[model samples]
Target chain A: MPLIKGDQITEDPWVYADDEDELPSGDVVVHLERWEKDKDSLRSRNGKLGLILRSDQSPELVADDLAAFDLIALDFPAFKDGRAFSYARMLRERFAFEGEIRAVGDVHRDQLFFMHRCGFDAFEVENAAVLQDWLEAAREFTSVYQPALDAKQSVLRLRHHTKKAAE
Target chain B: MYRYDEFDRTIVDERVKQFRGQVARRVSGDLTEEQFRPLRLMNGLYLQLHAYMLRVAVPYGTLSSKQMRMLAHIARKYDKGYGHFTTRQNIQYNWPKLEEVPDLLADLATVEMHAIQTSGNCIRNVTSDQYAGVAAGEIEDPRVYCEIIRQWSTFHPEFSFLPRKFKIAVTASEDDRAAIRVHDIGIQLVKNAAGETGFRFFVGGGLGRTPVVGPEINSFVKKKDLLSYLEAILRVYNQLGRRDNLYKARIKILVRSVGTGEFAEMVDKEWQFIKDGKYDLPQDEIDRIKAYFAPPAYETLPATDATLKDKIEANADFAAWVKRNVAEHKVPGYGIVNISLKPIGGIPGDATAEQMEVVADLAEKYSFDEVRVTHEQNLVLPDVKKSDLFVVWEALSASDMGTSNLGTITDMISCPGLDYCNLANARSIPVAQRISERFADLSRQHDIGDLKVKISGCINACGHHHVGNIGILGVDKKGQEFYQITLGGSATEDASIGKILGPAFSYDEIVDAVEKVVDVYLEHRAPGEAFLGLVDRVGLDPFKEKLYAAH
Candidate 1:
């Protein structure tokens, strides 16, 4: 129930609304089925609504509802199931969703660096004891080579930039 | 030959530290084995049958003398004083303590090497033609693109955890030495109508339970768009590749289901968005990487050296070795020398630390200080001068490295089956040794020229048995080990999977059956026809009859 947002752990404000429970105040996260069923009622409430997507679920299906949510958390289910990493990137890069993208369920310290690079700014880690480990994991590598939604300057770009500066 | 810059060094060092911490956590009970398996696998470590095995990536099969010595050092210190070269052009140390892996990786990082992506479900070590830079008539150096792909695929955020492991092979020559047809994604550097170099893409080619040669997806993609196109393909596979069934998880399965035409269209449509985007490789970066692979310094000499001729004439063994182990290099007076790891009855790719150090010394002295690991599980000194071949031969002969069995029946590609691999159903090394001893005589092996007998302990095809000229696959028959034979498979330019030759034979009868098949080939062949050529000329019926005659 801990949320990591850009090197800092903060209290998770988003509450999951179960099928039988009423929608909570402030920001609330619900599954796709719940969002589909209570879209009108959730919009009429005073709080913003977000949807939790499984690895099998596609963000393209909810492209029209991007503007209505403050968070879109992609579920990993297992760390080996990497479909959410792609989903996060697709949400940010393709669908152009500008919200707090989070990684949920079975997130490990080893994957936080890549999770951030894939456009997931927030992580829902189960154990708060390993929060420091997770923060250190995000800074494991000083440079990367590939272009991603995170837009960190790559080593190749840095090399060229340094060479040009010297020139 | 690609030297690691400051950035490269830092990345590898950071990875080593991260893995070190992870290993410490795993050993101290902070992480469960299930939680640590993927992490260790990403660093190329696997818990085998007896002990932990660490697979070190020999990227593109290219290595410098310093790097080779480092591998040898790791073998001597961390392992059982020897390492097994895999069919993927990587090396595996069968015995290494889990705690010592970080230190081992740190030593590897000193030489700009790490084992990342060697065993994970990520894009595995990008393989290329073993003789990439020196091979004659190559369109361009394939390692350039292989290096590009290596960078793009390393720790890639989106495609790192794919449905299954992915493999990519690249070849710049007209003859596909890298087995471009049987990979998940194969790239052939070709010239288009405008006389500019581009890539011909092949998707869905793999060998396993179902062996299929990948079909061509795009005839030609421009050079500038290689990364974008490849990213498109990976994006499509990551989103739609089968996640429900492990057996049908490779991109090849997806390509088969969707059809190559439809897959190609999807890739093309995906390519539209990213074709001109940030992944487009810049010319300066390409030039920077290309500079690392420029031709090594060479002395000006005649095409054929007289000293080599004189030495060969004097020593009959040297002459025989020259006929088999030496290949033509692009540079005048230089030859590509294949040092056979398949000595008469030895393991296919096992090299002791002493033997490795000897090769490193020989490479430093004779071959421009460089070595290469071939997918055929042999070592290569790619720039040996023809005049220096005799000395190289003598040094190698001292260590039993010069067997004069390159590309012969004895020079087999074998996987570490049940002997070390936990996934194997039957043992593969003893069978390979039996076959090698059965055909040990140098003259006899030469007489049966260019016969590749690849053996795998299981159907995973780690030994590449599906593409061997005389393929032998180890199968378990009700707790007994039996072998299935496939004929006419060639991993060369004319890549084709061999057809099964009747029922499986017991281990005792497998070698004799192979001998019978060879006898049939020897009896019914035209002049200048190799074993593969002979099988092509005549169908598999004759060999099948001879093999299945008694049983």
Candidate 2:
């Protein structure tokens, strides 16, 4: 299967020590928006568990009824449509569910960093130029912000509070 | 009045470049009106009835003297020598060329201001009580939280494309001058069982075709969870809100349909994920943003000045103006001064270039270089010393900004209805002028005591007519300008939508219709009962009986 995620494109993707922790399929069959209508019915299907439903389909609803799935795809639909971004943020900050969140469909190359900050672990680009753009966009803006997921604690807040950093 | 750091400056500069490119693309043949519409709207540019209008965000309606001067400069250079202050703590330039907007945005950025998110379906300018930092009644200035929300919502990655435009108003006092009851998210600062500072949130309140006084969603939302809860509400709206019909797109429709309790449950379920995230009230960030709005170095002075008393007694007009327009300040020597943008029968909230210059000069001379624009369509000198009241009065009178009507029936909040707005069904300015002229007598208005007259041209309720004590909605009946009059509506602590009084009235007959109701109130009111109180006591039947009884 064609994949945009996992370091298999660049490095060893599956770090699992044993084979039982990994799937037997050589290629993962990804989920699409049409399957979102019958996601509950498809969760029990044989080969369908390889991919996850997109974030645009109410991330909260998906979290509440998270039928055991390995990967979830967060689709941007367009660069301006932001519900998917908020969806990723909720998944990381609120749900506390540790899993691979993949960015897919309509996801632009420039928004990869923000997608990562919101908690997407992997990305699906439209083209090869977009792949390079995604890597560059992810590294350009360096300063941390307040609304970001806790990749780093708020140093500004800590500095202002006690007037000294804790040892 | 937050200062712009390098980060703020960079973001705004980049945004200006983006908007300029978008404008070029639209003008050239690269983009169509349908495609370019949202992009232009995000930048606060609108294609109105006559021209392109640019709305500049005056965050929480506060401006420094330098910023006020920049606005005056923009008004003279780009617009028709005037600016219109809006209810949501922003200013609108009615006559701006589409090509010259980028330059205007660049100028505004110099004053630490920009038009970002002023018009789009994003979180609009977070509004608060105009008397936030200096009011006698406010507890721990509402501008503090307003600033916090501003920083958090600025280029917020998640909530940019909401279902409909969102407005959030905060008020510390139980007496809400911010009209918090009529916003999408109305947050009142309240004390919990432990007497700690927190928020009481009300959701789904708004003023449009469907007027809803927001229902209480949270009794005590901790201060730290403000951003998380707001995210949850927006998430709920973005996900479940109606995209099929434009009229039903507002969150109020969703709340009314699904019920506020269910909506709150949905938000709570979403909030469970983010409340513990990194977006909390880290004391440092709050202090950093709060330092910008902290009170200025004020000199200790007497509360009442003998010199001012002499000036007031010498000129009866000046005394009436001082008593009516100025409000008590939290500090002993200072006061909040209100300069009327409405002069007699002139358009409400319209300040010409000369008037803006005078206001800027007064700000520089009287209370330092700080200024504020009140939601009441008036300019506010928020830190004026009580001793300088007479001088302000003189300067305002000379520039025709010294109309001594604040909160009276004559100080109506009116939009540029059919005169300029493409959406208005009927003309509103003419009706406001007629009503102002009718009640030109100061003594009559003083007797009327604290009545709000809000007029909207169409059902979109841009003028906020639904909450006015005397609400006038203009409509076209067979192409004739007829106004539907409503009574007992208000935007205060006791807020309610006005009740329609029978059939509509002709343009000429509307003034008579209002006068007849006032006459009825004057006849039936007990001692000290205002128009609203009288309506509550005698009911709409009395007013309805008089409107069509003998006519």
Candidate 3:
């Protein structure tokens, strides 16, 4: 899977660990259930811990242990499922998670812009061929109307700033 | 009437470019239809039964004469030389090709217009009272807040892919002209006891398979906290709204499931964090948008013009039209004229490019170069002089646009049913036409008086049948089209969902059935009583007995 960070498609550093698999030594992204069940063991391990939340799972459940995870990956499940977008924002804004948040599963070039706005710093898209497309899509719009976790200068702010400057 | 500043221009231009690329990818097979559906929908493009239908947003239903001409141009150049104005105060072109949509969007961008969020799960166009600024008894123009919501909701990253589509409507008038009660989120501007302007929030009111009247969640949210409150409500809905069932995905269902009190509590909890945060809109920004909707320059003329009275006395036709189609404006010497799109026995709300040009020309000449599209699927010249009534009527009458039946039975709100919509169960236009033809007599229509007969092709209530005084819902009964009737519903200060009247009627019997209901109302009505008022005093039993007597 290609992981896009900002304008670059850097290699994914975190290894995704599935159920029934032995824990990896380096930074590993585990399923939410697995992390919940073995949080102590996972934290005790020398490897960095990360949690991958399903679309239905609330980030509030894991907000207390948000600092334990080096990265958080949100599963889209489907392109139309937007729960991940809200989850990503909650982890960043409410949980005050400072680690990397990656979008996984059904991540497409079209959703890159919105996903980026919701505080996803990295993307784990299934297709590597559209890396350039993803990069372009991330920076497609010059202005945003809403204030998001990305803290991009909203159009209202820009206009207010311009008027104040003129004054 | 708001012109795009440089930042607005850049945003709209970028959206066009983005949509252009998305369309290219879809054409080149890079993106599948499933992937492209939302992208296209966000741009207000839909693949219907025949061709692509592009819904162009007339922001808060306000339009300049120039924008109206551009719509006419698009109708003539791209698709068929006609367009249908919707009940949401937007216009829809039925026959545009997918290949030409990008160009169409680009053209719209030129006039500070784009089809963004007209469809899709995102927040749709923020509709408002058509007579916002000009309407009598308005506290303030609702379009200022509507434009604020429009900006905040447009391309909202966290909300663009919600469980289902969202609709928001704002109204400043005490008389609910915008039908705020049946929207996903309805904001009514109110003055507090302290004379401070505040917002009253109504969450989760919608009409579809399940019709719900949104309850007032917060009676008073300070003007500054409006956006924050909205964000909180949306965040709660986004996380918890039912996504498993397509039919139950709207916020109305969630609000109903958890009860309005619980939902309000949840939203209030979420709002605590957002109320004074960065989401609180600045007073200067509100002032900025408010300036765009300021009352237009008007000549200082007498409240009543002698020439208009003389013309009315001289010409009976002009007098009748003035009584029906013209409304009292807030400004002196000015009258708001509703140009009837529901010409007798014509497709309701359908206007040809030539007619649009005529209206545009009329707006520029008679009105102050401003026009409004009413949710009743009609056009309004909001600043017409009382003196120009005769000339305006004459010009409109020449183009077969003057029907002199505003708020009459013939002035029906009918959705583009099976004729254009893929989701339609039966035809709505034909049924509306039959009803219109049945009540064709002008005197009879006027005598009947102020009756709203809304027809919907399906239960989606796009025609807003649920709130009409007399509601008609088209149903498919084992592949055969059947029309169901409902009575006593209203979209007003006293808003109520219409009650279902017995069994469904065949398409042929529906018109007569409607006539019988009207005749019953006429017979039972007391002196100076309206149809709805009669229904209110004397219940649906009278009309139902008359309607289903033979059956």
Candidate 4:
């Protein structure tokens, strides 16, 4: 698997850990259940922690503990189930999580742009050969209509600015 | 009409470029049909039963003459020289090759139109009353808010993929011409006791498999909180709506399962977090959009045109046409003229390229360079003057666009069923044509008066059979086509789902069955009572007895 960040495919330092398997040493990502059950022991580990929330889980469940993790990964069980799009926005715009937001599971070239717009900075794609295609997908549109976590100025704001400048 | 600004133009141009690349990839076999389906659908291209069908959205049913001419161009160059105006205020070209769609879309973009969100499971084109700015006694122009929503929902990141396709309709007049009550989300503009204009929201109304009139969720959401409120509702639906079953994915099912009271509570809780945030519409932004929809320039003239009166009296045909096809305009000398696409025994909603060019010419010359596509599959010259009525009729008649049956029994709302739709189980257009031929006499149609006959090929109800006064659903009974009838339905302010009347009628029997139902209404109706009113006063018993007694 390859990870896309910004305009390039970068080396992924984080490793996903299964619940029954032994925890990896550094920069480990665990599921929500594992993180909730072993909170005390995981906090004592010598690594940066990350949490993966499923499509059915909301970001509000970990609102108070958002500062504990260096990354939050949202899962799309299927590409058509889009609950995680809203969850990614809530993690950035509402809870103000500044860590890495990763999109995992069923990530494809078609959805990379929307996932990027919804504040997903990293995507764990299945095929390493299509990394360049995924990167291009994430930059498909030069402008957008609605404001999201990205810094791109919305068209509405641009229209108002243009009118004001002419005035 | 709202003209595209610089930002709007840039976005549509980029969209066309992006889709061109996507179509290239699909042609080279780099992308499979499974992967390319949603991408093409998002741009409003569908692979129908015959060839590719391209649905071009007419935003809020408003069209400039230049845009109408462009539609005529597309029809002449790409399709089979015709287009179908749909129930959702869209125009669908029934035949276009896969390779030619990118060029077709580029042509549309040049006219400030693209087929965005017309077929995808995203927020569809926002619809409003066909008579939006010109309708008398409207609280405020609904197109202003409809355009606002159009900008906000176009390529919205968080809601591009939801549980199912979403539709939103807005209306400001007391008369619900836009059919707001049966949409996924219906917004009615209202003035409060303190004389403040706001929105009355209706959530989860739909007309598919299980038809339900959306219940009122909030009485009045202030003007500033409109976008925030809609975002809240979408957030709730995206998070909790069912995705496991395609039939149960609409918002109406979600509202029914959790109950409207509980659904509203969930939306209110979501609104608490983002109500007054950056999504709240600023007064300046609203004003900017509002400026585009200001009243067109008009010369002062008397209310009644004496020459028009004399023409109507001297010519009985013109009088009949005016009586059925014209509506009062807010401006004194202007009239809203409805040009029926349903000629006697012809296909409903099908307009030829020449007819489209004729309408474009008429709009440019007589009606402030504007036209409207009504939800009833008709075209509207929204601001024709009373004095120009005879000439407009003459032009339309020359083009074969004048049927003079605006709301009569023959002006039906039908779908491109088994003839062109893969999802259909039986044919719909042929049945509609038969019924139209049976009631081709204009005098008899006017005498019967204001009966809506909607037909669908399947239970998906794209034809809105559930809301028709006389609803007909075509079913496939063991590989044979059969039609089922329902009675006592209305899509107005007093909206209700029709109840099924008795058994199904075969292909040979459906037209006779419809005639019998109409005959029963004509035989036992109070004077001046509409078909829907008659159905409301007397239930389906009389219709059922006449329809089934011969067995």
Q: Ten residues in a row with the worst lDDT in model 4 chain B?
A: B277-286
- TM-score of every candidate relative to the true structure: 0.98, 0.88, 0.98, 0.98
Quick one: ranking by DockQ, best first? 3, 4, 1, 2
- lDDT, residue A122, model 2: 77
Q: Taking the tens digit of each residue's C-alpha lDDT, what string does model 3 give over B450-530?
A: 999999999988988998899999999999999999998888778889999889999888998898888898888898898
What TM-score does candidate 4 reach?
0.98
Top DockQ hit: 3
- Maximum-lDDT candidate: 4
- Candidate 4 residue runs with Cα over 4 Å from true position: A165-167
In model 3, which residue pairs have backbone atoms overlapping below 3 Å?
Answer: none
The regions of model 3 sitting more than 4 angstroms off are none
Worst 10 residues of 1 chain A by lDDT: A149-158
TM-score: model 3 vs. ground truth: 0.98
Per-residue error (Å), model 3, residue B408: 0.7
Report the Cα lDDT for residue B299, model 1. 90
> What tens-digit string does per-residue lDDT give for candidate 1 at A12-80?
888887876876778888888887887788778887778898888889888898888889989988788
Model 1: how far is B78 from its true place, Å? Answer: 1.0
lDDT of 1 by residue, B59-106 (tens): 999998999999999999998899999888999999999989999999
Predictions' DockQ, in order: 0.73, 0.27, 0.85, 0.79
All models: lDDT? Answer: 0.90, 0.78, 0.90, 0.92
Q: Residue B500: error of model 2 in Å?
A: 0.9
Model 3 DockQ (Cα-based): 0.85
